[model samples]
Target: MFIEERKFEYWMNRLVSHFETVNRKIDKLSNTENKINDEVLLDNQDLCLLLKVSKRTLQRFRSSGKLPYKRIGKKTYYLESDVHEFIQNGFSKK
Candidate 1:
């Protein structure tokens, strides 16, 4: 009877350890997904800061189609790469 109880306790400990490992994996995956989403939603504010431009100028660029953007419902998002390309194009002599 004592041996059986010991075996049950060992299995319970193994199960608890497995649960903790799975929980950690889930937490890591969630954090990675959040980071990816944050990257995609990096906004005009970040672009303005990077380009040293005003909000009004940024809006003008958006209206003129000089800067491509993503419109998610009413929110506007700009990719960092697009902002860099815009700056590069501004410096181009064509």
Candidate 2:
């Protein structure tokens, strides 16, 4: 069975578009060998490890609004952008 030219082109175009989107996402995830950027989602433990602090310190940061995070169920997540902003703004003890 022969496919119509227009139908073949449409399917090919859609496949190409889907591949392009997936390729873009892959590049975004693995763009750097060593550095993951602001698009990454980080949990509390990752934040504490990155900042070299205890889990309690992270809890205090969240409680005092020194950092911003999202809570889904019992787990929390912070965007790398927010953590970067918090660092750039200089978090200090009162």
Candidate 3:
């Protein structure tokens, strides 16, 4: 069988370039998201969706001091950093 060396090299370079572009975009978004997390407050609905947990669980966390939150008027909000910290602290080596 004959190998098309030039075609192989071209496709491989293209794939690597695509991956690099995707990685750079992801890194940028990650940094921006982290910055937004600490400064922004998330309402109960947003928090629930992000964590994929029910509202009752969130209430329990607040009551138990697992997650810190705030109240402005009748609405409750949580900082993104607090949620991130909560998840990180929960990691266990198994």
Candidate 4:
């Protein structure tokens, strides 16, 4: 009985340590994603900021194919290259 209890306690300690390691790995991955998002934000500004247009204008542009975007699930994202190209090649000189 005594030997069985000791073995069980040792196994429980190892299991708990393994869980802690997994939690740390998850936290590290989450932090890395956040950092990447920040860098991407600098390259790709929000629709309002990039175009200096209102929400309605952005919607119109998307619908009319004036602005290209990537729709991920429910949210829309614009690439920096595409936005710049639209300004350089598509838009008429103002």
Candidate 5:
């Protein structure tokens, strides 16, 4: 198909513009993911290692309401801030 030069140039520019918009959106999403990761959600294993306790001991903390956690599906996650506060509040393994 014979296309006019002006129409071809316009189409190319539009395609480039659309790609740029998509790239910007991807970058924004990547930045959001990085921020979320920076917030640092700790799972059971991470907490156990940091606290130097066994999984059963950590479970005790959860059951006793000494540590705050969020359970998603079958996995538990603790916010970094909450863990810091727990330690600051003099949490001890009994």
Candidate 6:
């Protein structure tokens, strides 16, 4: 069936408007994700790699209370800020 020019233009405009709204929502969600990533938690391996240390050394820090960590079940996680502070305060094995 043949369609009128006006109706076709109207449909195209509506489709474009819908896509614009969807794009804006996607952009907003990405920005929120970036903000969350700023406070990202680091697991044992990530912390070790960042500090260039071994798992045994990390255990020593935790045991001596030199580094702060959160344990959930059998896994341990450290906050990025805490690691930065630990570095700033001069991490040394006693």
Q: What is the C-alpha lDDT of each candidate?
A: 0.74, 0.84, 0.80, 0.67, 0.85, 0.85
Task: Give the per-residue lDDT of model 3 (tens digit) for 1-94.
Answer: 8759998899999999999999999998876631233487888898889888899988988888888988878988888778789778771211
- Candidate 5: Cα lDDT at 14: 100
Question: What would the per-residue lDDT of candidate 2 be over residues 1-94, giving only the tens digit for each residue?
Answer: 9999999999999999999999999998876432235377788788888999898988899999999988857988888788999998886654
Q: Quote the lDDT for 3 in model 3.
A: 58
Q: Which ten residues in a row have the lowest lDDT in candidate 4?
A: 34-43
Which residue ranges in model 5 land beyond 4 Å of their true spot?
1-38
Stretches of candidate 4 exceeding 4 Å from the true structure: 1-45, 90-94
- Cα RMSDs, all models: 7.0, 8.2, 8.8, 7.5, 6.1, 5.4
Local distance difference test, candidate 2: 0.84
Question: How many Å off is the CA of 70 in candidate 5?
Answer: 0.4
Model 1 spans with C-alpha error above 4 angstroms: 1-41, 91-94
Off by over 4 Å in 6: 1-38
TM-score of each: 0.51, 0.56, 0.55, 0.48, 0.57, 0.57
Q: After superposition, how far is residue 53 of candidate 6 from its true place, in Å?
A: 0.8
Name the better of 4 and 5 by TM-score: 5
lDDT of 5 at 45: 86
Which 10-residue window of candidate 1 scores lowest in summed lDDT?
33-42
24 Cα displacement, candidate 6 (Å): 18
Q: How far is candidate 5 from the true structure (C-alpha RMSD, Å)?
A: 6.1
